[model samples]
Target chain A: MRIAAQAVLYAAFVAVIGYFSTSPAYVHLAPGEAVVKLSLSHAGERKEPCRTRSEAELAKLAPNMRSPTVCTRERVPVRIVVAIDGTTIFDVVAQPTGLAKDGASTVYRRLTVAAGRHRIRAELADAPGGRMTYSATTEVDLAPGRLLVIDFAPEAGGFVFRS
Target chain B: MRAALAASLDACEAAFDRAFGQAGNPWRHLGSLAFLLVVVTTATGIVVYAVYDTSVGGAYRSVRAMSAGPPAGLALARSVHRYASDALVLTMIAHLAREWLRGHAAGFRWFSWLSGVPLVALVYASGIGGYWLPFDRLAQLSLTATTEWLDALPLFGEPLARNFVSPASVPDRLLSLLVFLHIGIPLALLAFIGVHLLRLTRPRSFPPATIAAATCAALVVLALMHPARALAEADFGSEPMTVAFDWPYLFIHALQYRTSPQLLWAAAGAAGLVLAVLPWIERTPHAPAACVDLANCNGCGRCFADCPYAAITLVARSDGRHLPRQAEVDPRRCASCGICAGACPSSTPFRSGSDLATGIDLPQAPIRALRASLDRALETLAPRPAIVVFGCASGVEVASVREPGTAPIELVCIAMLPPSFVEYALRAGADGVMVSGCREGDCAYRLGHEILRARLEGSREPRLRARVSRARVRTFWGARADARSLSAAVAAFRRDLAASPRAAGPSMPPKRREALDA
Candidate 1:
């Protein structure tokens, strides 16, 4: 009886290995990127954050960057904002970095940048380092921006980053 | 019909115990502690390789870093991985050979033989996967050889090696599949281990001090030496570098490179089948049933429960306590786990006695306790010419621990004292600890001295200088009653300590080296 059981187990083991050996799917992600989408509903029923694609709306950044201005990991928080000039050349979604903090760090619009001064202000994600803000202006020249809000959060989050 | 069924069942029960008698053997289990470490290795490897990226150059460094990294778990995990692999293969081989020698693996058990072949294959598959992860020169060559061999099979369409040219030429997805196999194979190996333990009561675990110290020391040394650096990332097209083989399993791979892969597989499979069916093929003669030491019996019911056959039953004794009652071991119904013997507090106080038991006698539990006491004493003692003294159970007990004196502390069986406690004593400010057990075979427990001797020799740890050198904590085995032997052992150890220069007394926080050593 033990021998029979051993045989059955061995066969099952082989079958599992043979099947999965061909290929297996896995999760992939880069460091420091947090992906989030908001769910808001004006009517009675609940709904997902499914704002549809309209050329005009996709082209513009959210004007109220200060309202939802905090992003955190653990207790640390990073406050930042996304701003763009009238010229549109880069898609916010394509940009892996730079997003706004409304207690969150996610981009919502496609903004273009060229070789000139542009300011993206950010603060430490949490306390002890609160009230600290850093701003830098850099040049960017690339394809004309499309509708993408490259969402980002500050390093202040308690999220322990694995290097 | 009922009578015939009963007779057949009896026969089966007897046969069962006849097969697994060694499961009760402490030496066998002591040896198998290696299995515990190996299991740890496979588990850690599965986790590390799971997250590994399989691209060319990246795969090697990533695996190297993961295996040798400073991460809290990575280095320890890799050590466990290697040790476990070595231990599993060693024990499996030992288990097979012991079965063959005992004539328990033959005849009607052919199915076990055949099934075991796949398990052996899976072990090799996991081993190869480990080799591949390093992506070192040898790793690339090994993979190339493997792929080339696969291509030789009529079923394969193309030579996969053609893709090794440029980074873009090789498909990352396909490489990912190989990495997946590397991860998946070990997880699959775990299933085999589960099956292996199904029929047994408890799978063996590593002996804490010996196994832990040996495994850690081995890893530290290996890390200091080879450091497990990766060879160049595997290129599908490049010719592999020539290298030595890992004798454990890859010997066959090297042979395959010389001969035909098909022939190698056929030979391996055939050999494995023979081994698996060995228990049934070889027949062990039935011996008389084991006698019970009822006086020592605590009525633990271990023997009663351990018996695979219904030969032993628990019945009310004169004092109204339940004890195992003997009945005929209807020869047809037994599989000798002697778990009864191992579990039997009566028949086996510490040692096992089977219908056909191994001649090794283990010291009783009291002796083991005495040894542990000696260990505890050294651990609690303060610095002196800090020295640990061990004396056998039958040896003279000193009136009291003479502070800074040259007398041995008595113990029943030194095997019960672990090496770590000695090291711990040194860290706590003891100069050294010493142990004395009975002379070789003369020990009342036949193998007590031998077992203690093996452990003492194996107890060496570099970081704990006080633990390793004879001047520090050391061990000697002689008749417990032999004052001359005890005095000489103590004198020698004391002389060594006194001759050596003493360091300043213990300071705050101790030294950095001792803290980081483990």
Candidate 2:
């Protein structure tokens, strides 16, 4: 009788956990959508201007500490926009990665779109002004459930794409 | 002061044993139970890992989807994983506390205790890494506090807290590192567990099946009742209004809000150092390890198998004997419980030789001396139906049980008593044999009382013969504080013996029957 009671208790325990762990209902979505991923390794270089020291400013400096000029330590934020077939879908400004907020900026995003993209236009601005520092335009056909990637390479001096 | 504290702890442990019956008791096997819980946590963690997204941006969404979206079992599995981690910490603490309180944290037992200190740190690291995987508000708080703590050390050139300052600052690789640590530390913990059990002859890697099942069942019930869910997405710009802490593993993080992290680390480091060096702090002289008498040893390997500390090994005999091997003892590993002597077939008390010896025996208290003591105790008993009470020296003191017709004899541990001694005492005119040892699960030599009990119950090797009437024997477990109860047990045994029919009537030998009848 004791064994039977223990067995019943164990069975009840398993049942309750089993009931809570499994979903009785779920929604399954159709699978024809494609994803476009964009990644920026480093935002374009800073656009802050350097100022030359005046004669009086140089006179106050120590003999060993003299230098040409002083430049701003802040970095330009990277602003990016993505357009598919003349329709803009993604736009955001990504800040630099550091405790002082002066390091290089990086971005990674995934945008889901209907299959068979006609044309894709991407732009990025790393300066304080809203000027396109880099731009890429390409025409490509996207397959169902495919992933298209757009990444920036400083050495290449432009955006690169792979599908 | 230390002695007083130890005495009080022993008293408390004895009280606990009396309140809770020994058999199937979970507290008796906390270390094994903790190992079992780790297995449960790992099993559930593997399920959660299947749906985990390692990317920083998708990590939070994937977790939220798992707990709130489809595959309903996923959420429950996640909760089980969380609760089991908490349960594992709880059991590990209890196991540590029990060992400390019972005074098993020092001397030769120090290796097991010291190895466990690092295990606590590893479990904490693994648990916190699990929390960091979801990228929720709580995870963010945990990550921030952990980074702040890490930054206090001079090892890193850049403060790690910089990584979590903003979403852009945190990289997907950071999440990968967390996953790697969560998996890697536990594997390291598994290796440490192997080292922890290396000294023991037969370590119980897992608890009894029923206890394991019960622990899992309890974890499941907890998971169902209080399912774990991911909090809101971490917003770096916003200050955390509140953070729920799992106290078992996150109490140190909670301390970060009130005290300096350096102070917390200092206190924790000091405590860990003390725990690691406890064996040296409370050094006590242990009995000399057992020695093997190769002349009497036939190399049965029984002593080697029965050694609780794995101190004995069988080596090839050099004397050109028919038997292939002989027993050898490792002094450092042996606790000198003399259980090997009990397992020796030559340990039977029926030997008539003037100098009695066993194949393997403790030098301090050899089998011949023990047999001599037993014979003397039986010879001194009164003419009435007498009872021979066997007690452990480490347990209740035998000298205190002053029953008129009962003769008390003490051994290094009751486990050193060969089963045939009970029959020998009975045939030598004792009416009853009463054996006692340290309270259940509180054996001074780890498994002494357990092995003794199994032998008496006929389940283990060298069991008591069936001819020995079960009714003529009784076993009682008690501690130093249990003297009065032990006395009462002896008195009750006397009454039972008086009530039963005398065995010295017609079935006995004529001369021996005359001596008893007179």
Candidate 3:
């Protein structure tokens, strides 16, 4: 009888394992991307394009952040606002805006995507030469799409884009 | 010194049996199962760590590499870790529930209640730490969420997460410390498990092989389907992460992220703590046998001997009256198994107040109820020769003795059977309904079977030249190993069922399963 009871328990253990293995596990990333909007209302005409920000960028954008990283391009101070599509993905270091040409001090962040072509864009939140916004958008092929975004400008104050 | 030590050891071993040999000691078995899982987790954790890297960038990639690397021990190790954890949880819940159900948690056993809370906490902490090692996007996110949550507590001034999130700000040493804590906590759990079993007299180690096999198989399936991977290499400042459920631990994260964090934590924590203390808090009014009057106490240590828990102590008193020894009941260990009442002498004025036999009596109403219950259960059995065997819950395995062709029935308690029901079965031409019970004083349900047996035995009355009885119910006590006893009782009942004149009286309707399944 004892042996039989042991056998029954052993069978139950096996069945339990079989049950769990077949069940799917739910997975999610923290500080994941969420679409947001930045309204640029000139003369009460609002052109608010949706932008996305990584959590770190949001923190720097936060009112209380101290000593946020700054990105410099061609010896010019540039603070760029990163946006996926039209949404601001991140606000550059210490409220940095625009792009930089110098690769050093470029702000890069990682994002995960499903396998497919994804549009990644970096636009100038605030730039020199009359609020110039040097913007770039491109479709990159990704398998379980993952990429690092690096936005640049010639200097901290200047940019190439006219719009 | 050696001789004295051996003598003490021998004496302790003897006392161990005396203390824990009774029923409801399965907690000892639960402790053993917990120990095995701890061992598996430690052994597997070491192997994963040897090839593991703590470098901020390398941590995630290293885990992925290990998962994809030599499939040798990795699969087995992962399965063992996963399933053993599941098994650990299952055993803990079962052990905890059983204690509550048996009312062992009430009274002085509250220490087991308090210590159990920490064990549960440790399970969650260590389980979360395991997911962090995977270093996938999900792992990264989990770390962020957990650390951020931890930082919410006043324990840490600044966000504790800041130490691990940024590239330069976060150090490998801090990451290593997290890893150390992760590995160390299970060891702490092991220590707690030791303390958990210390009070238990007999510790049963190793779960039955089937349970282990089921646990292993389920884990293997999980590992295969998900194939533990790093969703993406760990990069500081990366907000987008892929997260997967750890099932046990992830549910908390899921609840927090999807709903309100404070609410989830508060509700879950409170509910879990309450459940942990429930066994201790619940007080069921057992039959009158539980109450003992000191004045009615007899010198005979019958109650002391009958108690499954060593709750009763026979104290020698110098009172000059009728009794020399009085049975003192301890609120601490007394499970209230009232065998002492039956053993008390009838002539003594202070016989045991508990009448286990009275509770066992099958009055007419309960007998009809038992009949209805049997009718309901038999609806699933084939319309062939079926013997309904109603054994005490603890003696359920006795149903295995039913002849290959016979079907068995289950009941909550054997005392629910009335004498008329057995006569009704005989009148219906059905086979006997045998009520198998646990050994005399070992009933987990406290004298349930003893009462029923006494009622049946007491019904025996003599007639002219022969003894005639209305109900031909056969009652037997089943010892744990007495397969022979089980067989003899069933065999006798089977012969009686076959030989009875009512064998072909009425045919039972076809059971419902065939039509339902079809």
Candidate 4:
């Protein structure tokens, strides 16, 4: 009788482990939903503008080591605002990477919405008063479970949408 | 409140003891059962890793291929590995709770208790690392959430999350490093396990055969029925959209997202701090440690062999005796349980005129005091068939079992009562002798009842003399909550002894008394 009880307990425990191992599927996304992950790294304009050095100041340096201009490696903190339709979903004043602060400012944020056509407007302000130095406004039709990304092209000086 | 809690735990243990019998009880052997689960995990893990691919692209491919067939076909090893790892977490937490609830983490046990604090995190880390190796959608969720969570701490200069921010950012070598972590963390787990068991003497590596077999069979059945499989492969641009999640290890990520990362960190930190400081908070006051007497010690080495904490060592003889070595007790490791006193061959009460000191003895509960207690207890019993009851203070409370014509002598632990005392009780006025301790496998000092039983059964040294009447001796066991059962057992033994006529008087066996005097 004891052996039977032990065996029944073993079976019950096994059933629990078996059912819960992979059941009640997790919903990472709702039906008819798509993801727009805004991922880009872009350094803002220099905090202080470069100026040409006078010969008198250059003379203080070693002869072979003199440069034409002096510019700070530190980049200005950039205020970014990304909107989907009319709703502002992401806003941050991103600091540049690295100790010298010359590295690119970056952001990776995901916005999940119902799959369809929608307006995505991303704006970055390098100067004061939220003035837009780089910006893009585009309409995209996304399939369910598809991922769309808004990235920055430094050379193009604007956001590039990819699906 | 604490007494109520301990009684509830004992009642639950008593229920299990009825079903499984004492030796095979799961609640009593939780530590060993957990260790056994660890072994099963490691064994099945080796089988799964044999076919696992470490590259990011190939990892999902390899796992999916393995999951293609019936459970017994190709997924056997993988399913078993996953289930065993999950079971390891369950057993480890149960072991921790059992020790903590029983107040087994104070005084001489502080070292073991303190060392085990970090093990909870280590076990989780090991399981989390296992989840990442599959490179499926669930693995991506685990890997990304973990990296982001760790980035909250200042140790890593670059955000670990940056590696998973985009498809181009995640390098193939990232999977390789994760595989390395999988190996390194479990090795650390093994090292910490060794440290955890260091203070214990002859620590049990596994549960008894019945439990081990039953647990293994259950894991196999679960694996065969469920047949663990990977979700769709991990991709950086898009996240997993409705995965079949393994909640055991992956629940951390769900929680990390539900409550903010800062809250989770605070909770985990608070829990760890409490566990680490609990031993000091409940520091039990120490009894005087056992001290060895070289004059009485014959270098027989029995006490050294019987010290449950490995506290006693055989040293070169310091006295004039011709014996090569004497027993020495390391006070720090000694728990003052007095089992060593019982293990001493010279612990015979017949040498009443002498100091009554044994080779090794607890200063708190010395042999001389015990002999005196026995003499006084028998005196209280009348001229009828008197009964002497020896009980462990940590086990059944003998005071509740005490009745007229019955003498109850409580010891620091059950094994502290020398087997010679049982024979001495029967010969010196008691019609029969009864001994009780913590229910089998639940010894407070871990080996008290086992060593005592061995001694009486003649399998161990300082055995009860063969001339001693076996019928006049009886042994019973119970938790402190089992006083009613203990009383019942004692009454039964009393009746059995009364049925067989035996005259009881305050008289000693003349021949044995003469032999000891000479």
Candidate 5:
């Protein structure tokens, strides 16, 4: 009788392990849909351009940090917006990823849409201005289960779309 | 609410104890069982780790082929790693909860408890790293979610989530870093485990063979029943319709997506803070440490040998007297349980009350006071067949065994009752003596049961006198819930005492009472 009970307990223990080891599927996106992922990791242009400091200004600084060319590591926050078929699908004002605002401003947002051909428009603004720094408008046919990756690479021109 | 939880834990333990018996009870061996699972996990992982390709493009294919087995041993090996790892994490959590609930996080255990806070994080880091080696859709999701969560903190100047943005952005060398991290972090965890066990003397690091075998068998059966297979190969540009998540390791990923990473970090930080400071929340109740009497100590080194904590050490006797060595207590590590006093030969109750000093003893519960308590208890023990019970505070309720013509003398632990005390009670007019304590492997003072056992069996110092009738003595080691078994043992001892022709040891000395009163 004790053996029977132990067997039962052993079975229950294994069942729990089996159930939790891998189960309860996580659905990331709805069926018959494609994703338009706006992925950006770019350092924004400086809020203010570098300026040559006066000799007095340089002398006032600590000996280790003092320099004639005063270029701040802090960069301007970047604002980005992406629209698909004239509908604004993704929009964000992303701050640089550091405590001192001295690093690249990154944006990784996914927009789910129906699988079809659509006109995509993307824009980026590096400074606090109505003027745009980079913009691209393109037409791409996106199939279901495929990702339309909208990425930023200054060397390859801004807002390159990879489908 | 805590009391309710404790009572429920007790109930569950009692139920399991009956089914598995004391030796096989998982509740009794939670810490050791977790260690066994760790060993199992490492063994299986070494096999799979040696065989699997650690490249991003090749890892998923290799793991998938390993799972869809032509070689059953390799397939089983991979499955066992996953299963054993899952079991390892769950068992560790269970072990932590049991220790916390039992109020083991406070007092001398402060260091052990505080060091364990990082162990929880290490377990997650190690387990999540294990999943990433497969490079399946689940691994993709885990890696991406983990990086995004980590990105919320400013530790990295640039966001880490950029690596998961597109398939092109993820470098081939990234898998190498992940492999290095998976191996390196667990080695750090192993070092921390060493630190955790440092304070404990004679640490029980392995479960009994029966438990180890059963645990392995259970995992093997689980692996056979449901072989662990990888999800479809990862594509950063795509997501699987639904991915099967390893809930043990990937639950954090689930929670991160469900809530903001900042909120999750806040919760984790709050929990870590609470756990780190939990030891100081309550003060140690039994605070009086053991002290040594230089004059009475012959420096036999018995107390030093019997100390469960490495608290007592032998040093050259400070006084110019020609003693070989003397016991010194480091009060910080001393438990003040009086097991050391029990092992001290000078702790014999036969000492006169005017100068009842032992070599080493708890100032709070001196063996002299125990002798006085014995005297008072024995004087009142009514009826012809009086039985005196010796038990411990941390064991069964000693007072609960009190009955007609029966009385109990409680000590801090059963080992605190010197073997001479049994003979003293027998000579002082008690018909029989019964020594009881915590169950065999569940000693509150760790070595109390073993020390007392050897002493009574005449195998250790201050041995029970052979002239004392063995039939008139009884010993029962029972769990706290085993009061019924204790009562039954007492009843049987009473019957045996009645059957025997009242062979009481030599009569008490006539002038001993005057010396005791003086």
Candidate 6:
């Protein structure tokens, strides 16, 4: 009889834990909408003026430290602006990678957007004059639960869209 | 201060044992239960992993879909997985505390204790990794706090905390890494558990069926009642306010709110070092391991089968003998409880001969010497109805049981007494025998008291004979500090023997004694 009671109690305990663990009150959420992924990689060539060292200046420096020509190695930061339906959604100054800040600047992002027909505009500038070094305007039809990718190809000289 | 702390912990353990130490109780199998819980957690975790989404954007949504719109059992699986993980930590802590309180954490037992320290850290790491699988508010909070902690170290070139600055900064590949760690840490933990039990000849890897069942049932009930669910979707741009925490595995994160991360790491590291070196800190003297006498061995393999530590093995005898096998003792694994000697049939005190030796015996205190001691103890007794008190060296000091007509005998462990020795004592004119050892769930030699109890109750082999009077034998269990209580128990047993009607003559019939002597 004592064993039977323990069995009953054990069964009840198991039942209680099982009931609570899978209690069917969890909220059901909708599936995520379409996403727009952007990938950009650009590096502007250094345009700083170079000067040749005079023999007198070279003689004043340490023998190992002498250089014939010197120019600024600082890279121009890539400025990008992304717009959807005439409204700017992304604006950033992407700096180059590496310790000397003279490498290519890269950008990767995924943005969620509602399914619809939309006009997309993107611009990038590599110099300090604020002139658009690269720009594109395109029409896109997005479907629910789909992905739209926008990428940059320097050889193509502009942005490319793939679905 | 350390001595006081150890005493306080011992007192607490004694109180806990008093409350829960019943025969066939689950509390007695905490280590086994912890292993069982780990198995349950792994099984349920596999089921959850089958449907889990690895991508950061889909991880949270996939969990929701699996929980609410599943093949129905996945929701239950997730809940069971979480609860079992929590239960595993709980049982592991209880098992560690029980071992510590029983004073079994040092000396020769240090290998098992030290191996267990890493197992705890691995369990915590694996459990926290599970939380990071679903990219929700809780995961973000865990990741933020963890990276912040790691940032305190000089090992990383860039602070890992920078990855959580925005959703754009974190990538889906990082979620994959979390999944890998979640799976990898447990595999490492399983390996450590194997190493921990390597020294023991026969480790109890799983608890008894009833205990395993009851523990599973309780976990299932908890899972069903309070199913684990992801909170709001993680927004790396926003601060996580009012994050819910699972205290068992995440209590350390709470310290982040009050103290510097470096200080928390220092405290945790110091605590871990203390636990790892505890065995060395408390160096109690242990009896040398038992040795096997090949000449006296009959090649029966009784000691090999009965050795609790699995330290004995039946090997083919190199020397020619009628019987094929002989027992070999492994010194590294032997606990030196002399249980193997007790199990040897040649250990019977009835075998009369000077310079007696058993097939397997302790080098420090051999069975022949034990017999001589028992004989001397019996000789010192006053008269018939005189009591023989058998006590363990690890338990209540037998010297404190100063009853008028009782003779006290100490053994490495009370289980070292062969059952026939009790009958021999009775036949030698003692009225009754009382045995005592470390309290239940507190045996210094792990299963010593349990094995003794089984032998006395006539359930296990080498059991006390049916011919022996049940009323003439009593067993009392208590710790070394419970010497006064043991004395009272011995006095009460003497009174009970005095009140009972005395046997007419010798305990064994004359005809039976004559046949046995032949």
Among all candidates shown, the one with the greatest TM-score: 5
Stretches of candidate 1 above 4 Å error? A1-163, B1-27, B64-84, B102-118, B151-169, B286-302, B308-333, B336-518
Residue-level lDDT of model 1, residues A16-124, one tens digit each, is 3222221232111122222111111011111122245455554464655323323232222333333344333322221112232112222222112332333332222
- Cα lDDT tens digits, model 3, B1-518, are 64554445334323332443323223334555566676666777787788788766677767777767544457556655666676667767766654554455655555566667778888878877877776666666677667656644445323455544344546666557768888789889878876765543333445545434444455555555545444565554445434445555556766766765567767777977786766556755433224445544545665454344445677776455566777666555543333333333321211122221221112222222444555454545433344666665455465677555344544444443443344434334454556677654445544456556654565311001112133345666654444576777777766665576342454322332222223
Ranking by TM-score: 5, 4, 2, 6, 3, 1
Q: Per-residue alpha-carbon lDDT of model 1 for B274-345, expressed as tens digits?
A: 665555555555433434444555555544443433445555554444644432232233333222343332
The full ranking of all candidates by DockQ, starting with the best, is: 5, 4, 3, 6, 2, 1
What's the lDDT for residue B443 in model 4? 92
Name the TM-score of candidate 2. Answer: 0.73
- A-chain TM-score in candidate 2? 0.75
Top DockQ: which candidate number?
5
The whole-model lDDT of each prediction reads 0.44, 0.77, 0.51, 0.82, 0.83, 0.77
Model 4 ranges off by over 4 Å = A32-75, A97-116, A125-132, A142-148, A153-160, B1-6, B165-168, B294-300, B313-332, B502-518
DockQ, per model, reads 0.01, 0.03, 0.10, 0.48, 0.56, 0.06
| Worst lDDT 10-window in candidate 5 chain B | B501-510
- Write model 6 residue lDDT over B2-61, tens digit each, in one string: 567667766755654543443435556788888998899999999889988898888899
Model 1 chain B weakest lDDT span, ten residues long: B352-361
TM-scores, all candidates, are: 0.40, 0.73, 0.50, 0.90, 0.91, 0.71
Every model's TM-score on chain B: 0.50, 0.92, 0.56, 0.95, 0.95, 0.86
Misplaced by over 4 Å in model 3 are A1-163, B1-36, B46-65, B90-115, B194-200, B203-205, B209-231, B276-282, B286-328, B339-435, B438-518
Clashes of each: 75, 3, 44, 1, 0, 16
Per-residue lDDT over B396-465 for candidate 4, one digit per residue giving the tens place of the 0 to 100 score:
8998877787899999999998998998887777888889898899999999989999988999987988
Q: Worst ten-residue run, lDDT, model 2 chain B?
A: B505-514
Better of 1 and 2 by DockQ: 2
Isolated chain A: TM-score per model?
A: 0.23, 0.75, 0.34, 0.89, 0.76, 0.68
